[model samples]
Target: MADFDKPSSTEEEYFAREDIEKKRKLALQQADQLAAKQREDLRQLHFMKCPKCGMDLHTLKKGHVELDTCFNCKGVWLDAGELEQVLAQGSENNGKVMGAILNLFKRS
Candidate 1:
């Protein structure tokens, strides 16, 4: 008579290994997509050239919102609504905000 309850350990292991590899590939694909998206975001940011000198803008984070600064022309760039956000965050952390602003001024 055939054995009724033999464990198919080898078959189970093969399937499990295949599943792990599949998951690994999927994870790698997702990471590549995220990297591509981040690069695109940075590309768009770079396209926002300095109005004064037409150079790439560097980011400066103070309080809450991020501001762009032109290293070439020493100009600060602000987007819509970011000024209000910065002001609101500044009041909440006045000292820290002041320090950040001072640092930006020093850099300029």
Candidate 2:
């Protein structure tokens, strides 16, 4: 009768090593993808000086709304209702406000 117990020591070692290498490669690929995505997101965030006034146009958070304000011009810009979206993406409440502010220029 043919043996049907378990893999030999050498076979088990080879399979274990192969699995570890595969998992390592997958983790590296995931890390690279995450870094690339972060870079792209950062690049898309737009910043421009207020044309009407010299004051910088800065992001602000009031509740769930993200507004860009120019103190000198007394102007505010909203991202077409992106505040809620930013809030949804936040992992915690602490960063929700800041994340909403920074997401003003991020692409949907």
The candidate that wins on lDDT is 1
Q: Give me the runs in candidate 1 sitting further than 4 Å from their true place.
A: 1-46
Per-candidate TM-score against the hidden true structure = 0.49, 0.41
Highest TM-score: which candidate?
A: 1
Candidate 2 has an lDDT of 0.70
In candidate 1, what are the lDDT values of residues 1-108, reduced to their tens digit?
A: 355576488978999999999999999999999999999998887687997888988998765688898878788888999878877777788657756775766752
Candidate 2, residues 60-105, lDDT tens digits: the string is: 7666655677766666565775756555546457676656555554
Clash list (residue pairs), candidate 2: none
